[model samples]
Structure formats: structure tokens, C-alpha cells
Target: MTDLLHDARVSRGQFLRMMGGLAAAAFATACSTRPQTSTPSGGGQATTELKFIGVSDQKAPMDQLVAAYQKAKPSVRITASYAPTDQVQTSVRTQLGAGNAPDLHVVYPGSGSAMSMSQIAEAGLLADLSAQAWTRSIPEGFKPAFQLDGKTYIHSAGSSVIGAVYNKKAFEQAGVEAPPTTWSEFLSVCDRLKKAGLVPIALGAQTPWVTQLITYALVPSTVYAKDPTFDDKQLAGQTSFAQSGWREAMEMYLELQKRGFFNDNPNGTTFEQQTSMVATGKAAMAVQVSAVLPDFRKAASSPDDLSMFPLPGAGDAASVWIPAGVVVGLGAAAKGANVEEAKAFIDFLGKQENINAWAKAIAAIPLVQDASSTIDPAVESFLPFTKDRAVPFMDQRWPNAEVQPVHFAVIQELLAGESTIDEALRKMDEAYQK
Candidate 1:
């Protein structure tokens, strides 16, 4: 029957006979399809109302944008709700799946994570944003984060780089002269900090998401810098994480752990605690996404006490690559009753002025090419790499949702002294196949 289904000469009747019970059973459970209709691409009929849901961590900018959007388009009344990052990720997925999703909500970039654009889009939940005018301005490297199958589903106001956020005071205390520009120098700095009786890197392995940051920061140099086509090769079944530069990156992480470079009992530390360690000068540094620099500032005695530097994951400083991608971005629900209104708001949000203003308010790097917005000074060091040296987050190119969690779990196991680099990589390969 399987062979007949693929036979070129098989008649329709023969195909049906081969499919038999499977065909009838599928039809019996299938719901009737409803033709989808999209509102006019020209900012839809002066939307009267919009429902917006966003992460509370981004509330200030999101709220400000909503208010400004409402004033400019006074005909539309926008009501918004915000929650913690973790809660927003979970709730958005549940709501989108239940057909009760918000008219507009925040979605993570790329595939294989909770509330990620790829995951929701695969479920037929996101409104198509391919026609949005600003889509033309997005850089080619960044387009993949907000798009899937050449169709855009989310609109990122900007992007953020991941790197080592360090304490200048702690570095001085350890007698380190400057930020390292190579992997060996970085390890040496770590050794110096550890010898000075300081935690060189504060890690929060108890939070699974935190486990992926260092790997993401390192892999661009370890993997993509050498072979930019690594992900393409991976998709073609020509590569695997266990056998690629990813293994080198993950092994480096394990080496850092073995050398006593991280805070003790990392598995018990929370993200907030890890940030506080560096903010308070108890730790020399931490690998983190640039978006959270504000949280570290809040924990510090002086806002200027903390700053970020690009993590040089390769031995050759000139060849080092930086990790940059869209942070959480906005998405519209495909089947919402107010779909048109939501889309209008999205179009407005993508305007250069709006994108610039939103980027400034959140300390993000604006995505629109013409936007006259400045990046946070803390991340200015990363600007040089933005053009051609940036790589997307490693997991963003993952094949499915199962792979990320597996990567995180295995890393935690390695840090907990329960697994070896080989074991972790093997588990990752197994998950990648699924």
C-alpha cells in the first residue's frame, strides 16, 4: 500500500484502495476548512481596537509604544496586558493553541522553543506579515529569525547580541589588564580571577534557558566562523552537532566548569542571583544576552559598574564571531476576530519612527536600516560585528522543539557532574534526529 501510494502509474481508484481505512479515518476526524480572507494590505480600515499582549520585562517600551500608537491612530483603542518572560512564553502557546490567543502577542525568534514564531506558525496560528513594508529593510542574516519558509510571521523591532557581561571592579581586583580578545586569553583571565578568590563566571544552571547562553555566544566563532554553511549542511544531513564545532563549544563550557571558573552550586543559582553576583562585584563576569543589561544595572550600586564585551570564542581575535538575533518580537493571530485591526497596529509598529522609538526605550539595536536609533552604550562594542560577523542563535536553526530542551538538560547534567561531554553531545544528536 505504501509503495502503491507513491507509484506514478497508480490510478485514483488504486490509490484510494491502497489508502483505504487510513483515508476514511482521516476524513472522519477532519474538520471542515474555512477559506481565509486577509484585510487590505494598506493599514486596514483605521482599526477601532487592538488587543496586545507582551512580556512584562518589556512593559515600559511596549506600553509607551501602545500609548503613542493609540494617539497617532486615535480611532483605535489598544488594550494590553504584560507578564513575566516565562509566563508569557507558556501562556501565549496555550492561548494560541486553544484559538483564544490575543489579537497581538510577543513571540520568540525562530524555531524550537516555547512561543517561538516557528512553533506557533507551524500550528497555523500567526498572521502572515510578508506584505509589511518594513520587511524590506531587515538584513538577510536576521530575516531567518522572523521568517519561516520565505514568509514573515513576526516583526522584530530590533536585535540583541549575546556575550560576556563583566564587572570592571572585579577585573581590576584580579589584576587583569584588559578584556581578552582570544579564547586562551579568556581562559587565562578566568584563571586569574579564580586565583584572586573570585567566582570568574556566575552561572545559573537551575534555570534551563540560562544554560544555552554560553554555548550560543561561543558557537559563532567555534562553528559558523569557520563554516557559515554549517546550518545548511546540518539540514542536508551532512553534519551533526556531536561531530561539528558545536561539540567544541560545548566541550569548552565543560572545561570552564572543571576549572572552577563558575560560581559554586550553579545548579541552585537563579538568573537574578547570577546577575547580582556580577553587579555586586562578587563575580568577574557572566555570559548573558545584551537585553538583560538593565537588570544587572538595577542590582549594581552604580549603573556604570557593569559593562559588556564580545566573547572571543576563537583563538584569532580578528576571526572571532558574535552571536546576534532578534529578541522577542511581535506577532498577530491568524484567526482572531480582530485580525485586521491587529495587523494595522503591526504595520504602524513597523514604521521607522515607531521602530526607532521602541528600540531606544528598550535599549535594543533597531532592526530597520533607516531608523535613527542608537544602541545601548553597554553593547556598543558589539557594533563592529553586526555587519558580517554575527551568527544566529544555535538553537534557532534546530529542526524541532525537542532539541533545545535536550541541549539544556544535557548541559545541566554535565555541570552537575552526572554526564561527560560525549554523553551530552550524544543526547543532543539523538534529540536532533527527532
Candidate 2:
């Protein structure tokens, strides 16, 4: 599953579109702390101050990590800054390019995304973490995302899967006996939900990024599982989106729309509205990232109201594939002022207790090999797929940064009846050429 590497170039225009034309200041303000001098663990050290950045949605758990680290080693002061996920990526890229990156920052595990580990490592911006003790325990399959040219840089505590988060009570009310394990059954279930006066699927395409979730969820079984080399071929110019399995995966998306399984005006719905629909039982299901499970639970009257299942893209139940990856992890900036101290904090974050705590706080599957951490029960049903039946998010491996924007735009247009699947795929292929 980790055989092919994707292009990780992040363009300025891509960052701008990701923020929906929002100004840099529209992102959360950077949280800083007063500089203090104190000795840190790991023997010889000086009173050091560290600047850090992280994903805002996971701020709760990250705050716990900061507090824990400071408590254990009072000599080091960290000014931790967090932004919305996309903003974090953009900010890090912009800041890193300006030669003023944080001491430590969030990075995607592998060769995907604008702020992926490989991108930073390739730029010679990440401190090597290959010799760290915690790294020895990580399974081989999980190593590639954090490594570049056989050297490790990122210290990710866990991984995440993308799947459909469904309202349990709504399913029972709709007379849906079980989660579907095949595409046909999935459509049948949606029909039943609609018959029972429920929205089959709530899609908020107004948040353009949300438009890619359905495609990502289905491609694991449709494209990667069929040929793990599909991405490699794409990078080598041996294949095109219009001529590959992407057509089938996307046709499934059109099938849902054609069958009226999606909520009316998906093009007008915001992500918040989409989550609210499932939380309030207005919709039976939603395709979403596992990291946002807590958000879904918080908006619900009962936290257990939601559970996730692998998207049934395969025709039958025989070893279905899931979209999964090392969602986000930490990497020490190579040219920061407090390199040693930052590396120390990163090491502390790799401890068994910290890894488990971080994983639990964010509802992720622990990447540490011997850690006792377990995934959330809501996501447990899809665990089997993660072992060997999972594929990394396809967009992460795209040849050009512009490919994602093309993906978002084409999907939005398709959802709005402004484009067709063939046209969308052709546009993606053209983006790859650029």
C-alpha cells in the first residue's frame, strides 16, 4: 500500500483557494508564551524557548500534550500556535519559505499534501528522527509516510481512516438492519432511508473541500485496491484519470445524486450544516474523516449516536479497502532556534502514555507498534481494513498541487449539474499534465 510516492508540490494559488480567499489573519492567532530558561531532560541542555504549530481541530489534545511536556520539563517554554487544518498547512509552507518556520510543526505523514513530511524533508527543513527510540517500534508499513530517502523525520502518534459516519438511531428507525458491505446494498439502504422520510446522505458541497470526500472514500476499493501501482503509473504518465478506475468511482458519486440520495442543494450546504444533519437525525449518513468524530458527537444529544463503517465500494464483502493515512504528525524544524529542545519535546511526545493520550483525544489508531492504545469504538468496525485492505488518500499522491483544486472545482460543478463525470475526469487529467 505504501509502494508509490506522490508529488507534494504546494502552489501559492492552491493555498489561496484552500482558504476560500480568506486573509492570513482570518486564521487563528498564534498562541505564544513568555520565554523562560530552565533545564530539560536528556542530559545536557540550556534554558530554551520553542515555537510550535499544530492543527486547530486537535488543539484540545495538543494543549494536553503541551501542558504535559512543560510539566515534565519546566525548563523549556513553547509558544504553540494552531490554525484550521488547511490554514496550518498554508501557514507552515509560507513561513517555512520565509526562513522563519516554527521550531516544530504539524506535517502530513507521507508524500501527500502541501505540508507532507517528504515535502519538508526534501527541502532539507526537517531534523532527522530516524535514531529516536520510539521509531524502532513502528511497523514497516507506517514508516514510509514519515521517512524520505530512508531517513525518518515526522513523529506521528497514530493514523486515521475516512468512512461514512452514520446516525445509529436513524438507521434503526429506517429499518436498515446492518451497514451495507457492497455498493448495491449501499444504494438499497439509501433507498430505504429515503422511503422512511430521511435524507439518505447529507453533503455540504459549499465547503469545496468536502466535495472530495466521497471520491476519496470510494477510490480505495475502485482504484488502488485494483492496482496499487495506479498512482505510480499516473506519476510516470502511463495513465490518466479519464482512462483509469477513477471514472468508475466517480460514476458511483453521480449514481447517488441521480437517485436523489443526497440532500437537496448539496452545492449550497456548509460542512457545519452537513454534520448537523446527521447529528440531529435529519440524515442517515455522511462521508467524513475520522478525526471529526468528536465534532459529530458534540453536536449530538448522545455522544454514541454516531458510528463509522468502511465505504462499501467493492461489489461484494470480500476484503474491502478503506482510505486511511497518518493524518498529521510532528516534525522539528531543521533551522529553528531551539532545535535540541524541540527534538526533546518531540521525543517526550513519543512516550507510551503521551502517544495513547494523543490517539484517544483525537480518535486515531495508534501508530506505535507496542502501544496499548486502541481506536474509538465508533471507528472499530473499520479497523480490519487498516491492517492490509487500506489505501492512502489518492489526492495526496497527485502529480501537481493544482490537481486538488481541479478535483474540488470539477466535483462541485458536477454536483451542481454544471459538469459531467467524463468532463471532470478530463479536467483532472489536464491538471496532471500541467
Off by over 4 Å in 1: 1-47
Candidate no. 2 TM-score: 0.87
lDDT (10s digit) by residue, model 2, range 38-95: 5565666665778888887668778998998888987787878888887887888999
Q: Which ten residues in a row have the lowest lDDT in candidate 2?
A: 1-10
Write model 1 residue lDDT over 146-197, tens digit each, in one string. Answer: 8889999998788888999999999999999889999999999999999999
- RMSD to the true structure for each prediction, in A, is 12.1, 11.6
Q: What's the true lDDT of residue 178 in model 2? A: 89
* TM-scores vs. true structure, each candidate: 0.86, 0.87
Error of 1 at 170 (Å): 1.6
108: Cα error in model 1, Å: 1.7
Query: On a 0 to 100 scale, what is the lDDT of residue 149 in model 2?
Result: 82
Model 2 residue pairs with clashes: 38-75, 109-145
